[model samples]
Target: MLEAIRERYIFNKCQVIILDDDGIITLSDDHLFEVPNAQPIENVHPFFETIRHLFDDKNEEHVFHCIHLEIGDVIGNYNVIFNSGNKEQNPFLVLYDFTENCNYIQTIVQRRNESVIALEFEQIQAQRLQAEQVFKNKLIATISHDLRTPLTSIAGFAELLQKQQGTPQGANYVQLISQSATVIKDILDNLLGLAKLEAGVAETQLKKLHLPELTDYLEAIYAPKMQQKGLQFSLKKSAPKNAFIADTTRILQVIINLVDNAVKFTEKGSIQVFLSVLAEAATEPILQITVIDTGIGFPQEATEKIGSFQRFHSTDVEGSGLGLSIVQGVVKHLQGKLDIQSAPDKGTTVWVEIPIQYAAETATAVQTNSDASITLAPLKIIVADDNDVNILLFQQMLAEQENVQVIAVNDGNTVLDELQKQPVDAVFLDVHMDGLDGITTAKLIKSNKLTKHIPLVAFTATNSAEELDMLQKAGMSLTLGKPFTQQQLLQVLQQISATK
Candidate 1:
């Protein structure tokens, strides 16, 4: 009976032993047991005498005992039990060998523990890396902020001093100061640009534009800056040229950055920018712009992250490390490609390409023959603004203009009072006001039939096409975004007063 039950219960490689009530061995097949062998059932035979007497007094005689052992190669794990038969045949002892089964459980437990440890280790490493990246970013941000503030003050003070004062030394100092400002601007731009590229906002603007016109404008802006740096800059077109199309602004920014970097990094070197037509007879046309510079080239290792953020020259060539990152993003956004070839002491070349279609130039010129600039009697222009700096910048900008006088006010009610007392030619109103907000003031001014003819130019910082269009439909004759150049201000102001 014991053997049948043990055989059914012990599925793994195991054996069992059985014994009769007199401490006699009845069956033996405990070879699978791995524990140290003892004095057999004979050693426990004496202890049974003490408990058997108590069982007999209660009309229940102890018949047999069984011992389970985990032996052999497996370590010590065992159990023992005693049984007494009532109406059945004499009781017997049974032993179950559980060493092999115990071994399997231990193996599984160890493997589970190992897997858990590995997972925990991976999690810890990932967390450490993430923390380090954040710390590095914050550190860079702090460095950028600290560097730009003093630079801004230096640039502004130098500019102001140069415009008002004169001396041979002062003129030299002014040129040096302007050079310093450019360097600072480059650093700030790189830092902020890298930050933006890392933030994943660079390649998102998928705007398209004509390549030739865009290049012409950028070349014009940077050509003077490059000349100041003692570098010759030129642009070229490849054979089979066509109208170029792609992510217009981003691509332009990339090429511009590459050219700027080349100028800043090279001394007495020529920087040539050319568009390459790389269309296979069977594939889509690809446009490649290669920026070639005859400068001290880059190290093999350093060239890989040329367009990455916060990276700059090892020397004091001052850069914020964002130009390359922005370039990379632009290339990615255009669904094009970027490649670099450089070696120490040799010139470097960066090749960028984008898949695009081109448009041919039309022969007709812009038809507004009414001389783009027409002079008008500077009327009494009422200026509404919440910012004192803006008011000052605007007032200073218009101070030297012909026949112009500006009346500045801070509040909406003040605007009305000033307007009612004086006959004004136009209202230069700020859309963001403390009271009688811009829209409300504009609506009130429009409602009064007497003031309806006064053209209102909204001075806002949002020149987004949508915002400008909306404000125009809402009775704003002109929208001039903030931080505009002197020329832009003059143009908008002229347009408003042109009709009057």
Candidate 2:
């Protein structure tokens, strides 16, 4: 076979050594090899070097580097050691000049490095995204939970007054109800602002708004807040002022957000609003408005963390830390520049600059249609979860539903027991657990004759397709992932109750 291969490629050469049963060279072609001086093969090296077979150990494969006849400078190399075992009789040693293809080794090494870097980069990217997702979820969770208390109280008071009317204290109760509703409305407004900004729905409505009028209007609006907090507010402008064309409402909102932040951070110090003309280029004119406060400056360590969701005053303030992100968003939508200046224990100064085009302002009222409906009917909801926070959140969200009541319990074990104890309208069950998790719980709930009629809504953390399929197989009525909104809960509950 080797002779045929050599014959086929006439440029190649071959040398073969055949061994006898006792490990002695029986015969060899010895082709193409130059004998420096004719002598026995054993004279050039040890007997093993010219031996018929290489290894004698029992169970392991062995290979070794062996020297072959040196060729010219180009083809000088060693053997690529391989063994076909002693099971066959005609074993021969084959030689190749690996120096001719050294690039293969370098390619292997390069590929190894590339693979490692790819893996590391993948892990880093995944961790970064995971961190972002976790941040988003935690923000939603904190906001949802925080907003629940006040909103529930407002809704409950409203419902109580609505139901138990016609008493002497009705007017006082009505006043209290109005106050609670107002607080809720304020919170809702802030939250809606943040959502709109983050979701990119907050767009610039360009119209001509009188700059002086808008600033005065701001003073009138925040006068009470400033007075209530005992903080002084002053407004000033550069001598040469230029009126601007932009979104009036959005600009007002941005100013209010900044002022509100100032008020929140500054307890007893003064806050000031200043407006100045930045520049006037051929294409556009620029205006700068700054909100300066002397309350409490951001810590040096947390200075950069501002305008992000994880930041809050003392980490204990009543905010979701989304205030500055919204501020940034509002500025971006208006083609403005936002910069912050602060010092520890001093105060914060936020500057917003807007560039307006040559066109004058056009203010047109856009009609908004809001449905006025009071959901006063009580709903019976089953709250299932192992976490106290989640269960409490669900209870609080359902607290204001007019005829609605929540049955809170941990785990699915008592679901059957609770079903037997009361006739609930709907069930909100969490998915992750031990010993009868959501799938098992759902299967048990759906299989039972009496409980099957109740809608089983899954509350989960993982939003994977396989997880959803598994939940679907268990016959759940709906899937509501964790950190869901209060209105979402109400909507889901209403949906099931409406269908029934």
Give each model a TM-score. 0.55, 0.47
The pairs that clash in candidate 2 are 208-361, 208-362, 377-403, 378-403, 378-404, 379-403, 379-404
Model 2, span 294-365: residue lDDT tens: 977765555555434232332333352445656677777676877777886788888888775544434333
| lDDT, candidate 1, 242-290, per-residue tens | 4444555666777777886687667877999987666566776777889
Count backbone clashes in candidate 1: 12
Error of 1 at 59 (Å): 50
Regions of model 2 farther than 4 Å from truth: 1-103, 152-202, 237-243, 277-283, 305-320, 361-500
Best by lDDT: 2
Worst 10 residues of 1 by lDDT: 309-318
Model 1 off-target regions past 4 Å? 1-235, 239-249, 267-272, 278-285, 294-320, 342-347, 360-372, 431-454, 463-477
Best prediction by TM-score: 1
